[model samples]
Target: MGRIAVIGAGMGSLATAARLAVQGHRVAVFERAETYGGAVGAFRRDGFAFDTGPALLHLPAVYRDLFVKTGKRPLEECVELVQVDPASRHLFPDGTDLALPNASRAGVISALDAAFGAGVGERWGDFLGRARVVWERTRRPLLEDTLREDTAPLGRDPYPALKRGLLRRAPATVAAVGERELRHPGLTALLSECVLSYGLDPRQAPPSAAVLPYMEQTFGSWYVRGGLRALADAVYERCEERGVEFRFGAEVTGVVEEDGRATGVELADGTRQEADVVVRGAPGEPLPGDLGRFVVLLALRGARPADAAHRTVVHGTDAPHDGSPDGPAPTVRVLRPDDDRLVPDAGHEAAVLSVTVPPQGAVDWRAPGYADAFADRVVAVAGAAIPGLAERLLWREVRTPADTERETGAPGGAVPAPALAGADGAWLRTANRGVPRGLYLVGGSAHPGGGLAHAGMSGAMVADLVAGGPGGSR
Candidate 1:
């Protein structure tokens, strides 16, 4: 059996390690954090628990396949899947509230018809159909192909199948795509919300990403019984069964290369571990693209205004039993409120809000009193959306572009790898296989893009390549 050292014990790393161990390779996984699941983490304060990353599960088949291939029962048996009914509620300015049911294409169409008009649903169907095509055509090539082998230089460029399918026909901007598919402003705006959640804008986003909402609906958005972090723990459990070893609190400092090939890693703790292969599964900086907006997060103590959705507000409640101001604003505002009666603590109220600002260079927001400053900014830009939002806060926390960059290890805090808007942005994405041999990338960095499923697929594909297994380059 070959020896392998997998870096980072996030979902991607665990998946890679498990697959490699099942292949009879002696695999060891090193994680920088004290725990597994980089962003897929849970924190318990008092009686309430909060998931730090990934609230819903999309395309659960990806996880199920990983388990079945690794000699385990399907993921459904491992983790209880709860389909969120009404999927989600979208609030609009015109006092229109739309609840999207799980995979309810008809409902969504009907809602569009009621809100926009009769012809809108038909047009929506056409757009959704095209988006489904994008999913069908790109899923295997991008998500399932081993990045190392599939990306190996094939004399000339490969991935033409993926390139032609969604990348070419899609315009370079989210606005562009929306204009083409949607005639009504309201429907288009709703679609843009999806783009934002996926960390992109619909107009400039790669046509490939049009599949996101569809996948969520078709596969059905699921929540773990306890929390989203359970999914990470589930993957970790399977890895352990497969004999994958993990070292937490072991931060990777650098990749070690010799003779023009990756062979090992240097840890922040002053230790070097060698391996037959390595896969980078961490989030990465963004590729310069068409997105003109940047995000700032503000932590608050109360519920955001109901109409905050249209006025640049994203609400995450870490607290409860409180309220914030409401008004019109141009920037995105997020309100995360702490409710002690419902939540665990009385003194601990955590409210997270986000805003859209002009694209700027990275700046640090972790400095002293950064949270208060961020709250001030939120009130300033989205003040009309939340009147008197600032004075109501018990405490404030801010995550600036600089803070995200430093905290997430993403250059310029460019997580979600910038939006894959337009054909040019799509092509600019880095392939899994690097210029140097033996070096491969998984996680949110490589092709097919970010999100848990995409990262897991990247790791699995790279592992397949290392094992010379089926599903590598054909």
Candidate 2:
């Protein structure tokens, strides 16, 4: 069996290592961080815990499949998985609040009808129906299978919108589709904000991106009993059980390529470890694309109301955040999990408020009081989601893009765009198989692309390529 050198201890990287080890290969994971999880990290203060990265899980079947394949215990046996019922609550500029039901299309339509009016729900439902078409079309080739070198076939969208004349001229982007189909401004915001949550600009995102909302709405959003970070820990533990080694605080400086084939990795300390397969799990190539989030973890003084929504998005009003009076208002996502594990006690609540901001190149996240000032503005917007938020606040901690860069090693804290159909393949991530034979890319920056489920799919594809399993490499 070949020795595998995985670059980071992230979810995808760990998933790859565990699966490869189960296939009878030797795997060792090296991570620069002190812990296993790369971005799936947690923060604690005064006994209150908050997820520093993704707080919710969508499409947990990816991990469930991983557990079933790698060991006897299923995912639920490893980590207590619970479905968040309300999925999300949306707040609009017109003071309309809609609590969307998880995996319940009829219920969602009803909620939208009750809030937005009679036909608005029907319009959104129709849009979702189209989005489902997008999902079914691309789910297999773009996600389940590995990307081939030709890549031309993948660029041709399976959206079936243009030739079919779904619209006047086949809307160029998500926003365009939303504008044409969801004529209501509020509906446009809902569709746009859903894309924005993925760090994509609805104005530029391909219509194929609709698969994101489709996947979530169909599969439903979930949470672990502890936190999303627990999922990563479970994968790491599974790796250990399979005899996959982990080296913390070990950073890879470069891949040792010989004659167009990866042979080993060089550590930051000038040490070289030979391996037959080298996987790039961490982000090294800095692509200056997509906006990221500004997170504020609030430890509040009151218990979460029984009826309070789990996730609430305050749609960006026509406002700005760069101290300029003009740009569109940044979308804010507030997550207040009902799990008692997150709060200090039954008397208090722990919540996270995240705002999508322009990338570091576009916005100064480190200007004097930039993060703090921006955090204050985010809190103000979040108040729309959490009533009487100002009074409930006990203390708040802010996380900036700089913090992201420091933690995840993504240059300028730039987030990666999820794999989409159009953009002339510009949005296509690097293939799971790297240019050099034996070197592979497996993570958010790689094929399939970001979000927990996509990352898992990327790992599965990479493992398949390594094991000569289904969808073997070219």
Winning candidate number (TM-score): 2
Top candidate by lDDT? 2
Question: For every model shown, what is its TM-score relative to the native structure?
Answer: 0.76, 0.95
Q: Cα lDDT for residue 361, model 1?
A: 53
| lDDT of prediction 1 | 0.59
Off by over 4 Å in 2: 162-167, 286-288, 318-328, 470-474
Give Cα distance to truth, residue 308, candidate 1, Å: 16
Q: What is the lDDT of residue 268 in candidate 1?
A: 91
Q: List the residue pairs that clash in candidate 2.
A: none
Q: How do the residues 37-141 of candidate 2 rate in per-residue lDDT, one tens digit apiece?
A: 777899999999999888888878888889999999999889998888899988887778778999998998898889878988898888888888888777777
